[model samples]
Target: MTSSNTTDTATARREDPPTTAKKKRSRELIIAQLIGQVALLLAIPVLTRLLSPAEMGIYQTGLSVALILQPLATLRRELLIPFAGVRDARKHRWIGLGFAATLSGAIALVALPAWALGNATLAETLLATALILPSFALMYVENAFLIRHSAQGRLAVRNLVGGVLSAGLQVVAALILPGAIAIAAALLLGRAAATFVTVARRTPSSDVESPGEKKSQRSISAILSAMIAAASSQAVVIVSFASLGPSAAAQVAVGQRVAGAPASLIGQALTQIALSSAAPLIREQRPGMTSQLRSLTIRTGAAAAVTAAALMIGGPLLAVPILGPGWEVAGVMTAVFAVPLSLTLVALPATTLLIPLGRERLLVSLQTVRLVAIVAAIVVSSALTQDVFTTSIVTAAVWTLAYVPLMTAAFTATVAHDRLCAQVVNQSSAP
Candidate 1:
């Protein structure tokens, strides 16, 4: 009886660990990411309440410049995470090296030109922010590593530490220093700290190589594709601000920031899981998994849309007291902005599907079209009038109108491609 009991216990242990463990880890990641995002969200309202609009404007402008330049530093190597496992280490290293070098050089090259063009403040801030791009890129690389290793727990911890610390520091700065620059600096410092922590925890693998070497044809293609996509996406935001006035642009951006927060955090977190788990699916060429992914995308998109609507309707009432007096207008706009912002969830999965399928160029092309649309709308709106609200409406309409069909098609195509590939491989291997 004793022997049988021991055998049963050992058998139970071998039956696979409790689902609770994975659920707990996943929950932690979601919570941590949310905490970080909530911190960021809080910063805006708090800072807006404390500081002048002009000051907030300055900070927002700085952030815009940072966003544009940061991607330039990456050259999209971070996007390679999903497919990196299938490639050679040497190739991956070279790709990383080339991007890092290109990004740094690109920043330096832009400095003189930007200043010569008389945008010194924007240029200088961009340059300073550019310095951190490498670190951000590195953090992304580490993120890929953690995801690939199924270390979701560690990833959650890293994000939590960074998010919570940044939020706390921003609160302190808001109360103590109460300066936009100070707030910006605090955020950056927290980012740096998080990046360092992530890097420290990542143990180097023998397969991993430093980023500097002769590039492979595949990697070269990947880089070019990602660059185009990155450039297009960045251009839209830049044009949106340029086309509409800063105030309108800021409000629209806030909507995107707020309404899209859940999708961005949760969707992004899922991408890591998707990348790690999808490997076997890809290897096995499982079409059913793609269906599952599409289902998830749809469900999430619906949820995002509903959430956006709620925020749009409820945001004004919520904002009056929470964000203080000055942000009443912004709060109102935020809700209005949520209508278009909801599409982001649908777009996320569609965009990510290209990565594992090695069709990143498709993403690039879609975004390129989106950028062209943005630019055209801006030009048309500007020609008609300098009305910020009108321009914003036009821009939002353009964005929502353009991405839906494109993303749906992209998602469907990825599923079909996976299914077809599986069939072909299975047929070829048949006895």
Candidate 2:
């Protein structure tokens, strides 16, 4: 055999293991997401049967509030782990816990106003936020650490166990108490259990030291961007609850959960894989980084489009049967929601690139605009029509119009930055 052929064969052998490992990890993540989605799907019918629309609205409200507040508690420091050295990552974990504790205390204080005003539901939501935030933050930090260590199998186990346990507990809660608070407590306990298992399973080898790294200035931007993004996503339900009442809010919540499920599942699984695999490449200015980003964008976008089409066609037909009676409006709302959900899913994989590309300012600006646009749509719709279906259609339309242009800009910037990085690398390596 020629020397060139032999050298090429040797290089291929060296590269094979990392390629194989990544594939295995990707499969594990996808399987884990599937299990979680299945658990969620199974629990929905039972929960819907056990709780009335008003009660479900309360439960969903509590969940939305928790999600909006969680980014504040964690400050998104966990997202920095993969890009940080080991010591920095460990420090981030502790710092994140501190943030959670401080935010919990602040949330407790906020609950006092609702209690004084005799707003029982609002007060309960704030109290639940205080209790759940710490556990959720801990779980996020641990999961981020797992990603940093390439412990995808452990992360998969964490998700599988946590998802099933949470669903089971919620079912039991519905059977006994059938209240929003009870179900919320079940969620808190589930998160705590997940964090406990993650901590216990941590291996010493995962703590290997690496070179020191500079502290990130974008932590606040990350937190703000994530917080706004979460609020924007949940705004429709929250606003519907306040303006149109529980019944409308319930429809929006159910529609989002059911119609957005497939896109969310695939987006989340691909997000994990992208963070683990693509971060290092971007960090090191490795070749094929842009290609990887482009490929993931295409794959996720296609899956999202297909899922949205199916939901638009079949969601209304199946909603009544799957979710039981009185949820017919939810079916129609599902069709309305599919478009914006698909757009968001298409942009999901590219979001993590913002920080690595030093585009945190752009990230925050885009999210802020999105939140503003969504809120404006809700307000205008409520003022003009005050009908749940009308509100949903307007909100979805506004979201689609706003997101497409913004996300196109984001994608364009990401590719341009990647090309610039390649240029610099080529310039440095030239003779």
Candidate 3:
């Protein structure tokens, strides 16, 4: 008994370092994310004071368009990096950059027609988005590479630098240039600078190029799903900009930024950790994977619920102060957006798990449903009421409802996949 006890204690001591190291990495990432969010949060008041609602709306609309294009620009290849060998990952990075460049040129061509047609705003928005696409794509792939190697410390630094640069540049542009295009340009410059710094650092040569790592055929489905998901997430902003006009769009944008902060903080902090940790387990068909995913989902859901409740109660009161005067509507919209954003937060773990689980088709189906639901809500609301507040409420309700099925499907699929994996392992071992 004493010998057994000693062995158990020794095993625990051996395990403790890895567990502790993971915790330390998580802590650093979260703190860095928090710092970044705080910087952006602090800039909101100054931004609101400097830029008009219309200008802010245009800026946000441009951002939304860029975000929608981002997944396509990289072909979602970055998602493959964590599961890939080093050589494959390096190839993906370069290929992703090439895609971004091609897309940017295509966007520029489209913008020329807008310029010729006398839609200066549209042309500027498209051109700015075009300019930023490659930088954004580079950052995305590089970050994925970092996650592949568990370089959380470098990732933390990247996040810190990016957040600071983005916020500072935007503030300076608002002061100096005072236009939507200027704001977009600032974002592009900041992201480019951050990407440069991150890329300049040399990575360790520890990861081996395994022959067993084949390129996934699911890349096409993954890219489609990512594009659809990005568009769906930005649907409200896009629809509001088209149907309701800039002021309404601005209010929704500001509200989303403020109300979504908690979820963004939690989700971004966990996503890398989840992807890095879950990849090996899923690849190896490890036991307890399902339980680990379920526990993460439950805990994230609980945190989301508490935060959502707090935001619903206190968000409006704090919004006016944080966003400054002339933005009371933004405050109310913040409260209205709390539920949907929290639901998205709750669904993060399931979505993250789906990638390594190779459930790209399911992802595409889910995102398509969400996109249809959100677009229908926005269209119907705009036609019936033409009121921004009414539209926001309707969109939020529909978005919240849509997430129920998404969360259910994702978790159900994850469990089903885990069971199949187990069965396959059992069968192979039995013979």
TM-score quality measure for candidate 3: 0.92
Local lDDT at 80 for model 3: 86
Residue 351 of candidate 3: its Cα lDDT?
Answer: 82
Model 3 stretches astray by more than 4 angstroms: 1-7, 200-204, 211-214, 427-431
lDDT of 3: 0.78
Q: Write the per-residue lDDT of candidate 1 for residues 1-431, one digit (tens) a residue.
A: 99999999998877756666766776787788777767766766777677555445445554655555544455455555434453443345345646865775576577678889998555554554455455455546656656645567778877777766776777777788765556666775776688667652434562454332212223444444445444433443455555544454455455445665666556656666555556546555655656757776777677877878788787778776776665666666566557656766666656665665666566556666776786687668867987656765686688778777567656676677777877977898899
- TM-score attained by model 2: 0.90
Error of 3 at 148 (Å): 1.7
TM-score of every model versus the real structure: 0.79, 0.90, 0.92
Candidate 1 matches the true fold with a TM-score of 0.79
lDDT of 2 at 270: 69
**lDDT (0-100) at residue 194 of candidate 1?**
82
lDDT of 2 by residue, 198-284 (tens): 653446876665433334657788788888988988998888778767667888888887877776555666667777776666566
Clashing pairs in 3: none
Please give the range of 10 consecutive residues that has the lowest summed lDDT in model 3: 205-214
Show the colliding residue pairs in model 2.
Answer: none
What overall lDDT goes with each candidate model?
0.61, 0.77, 0.78
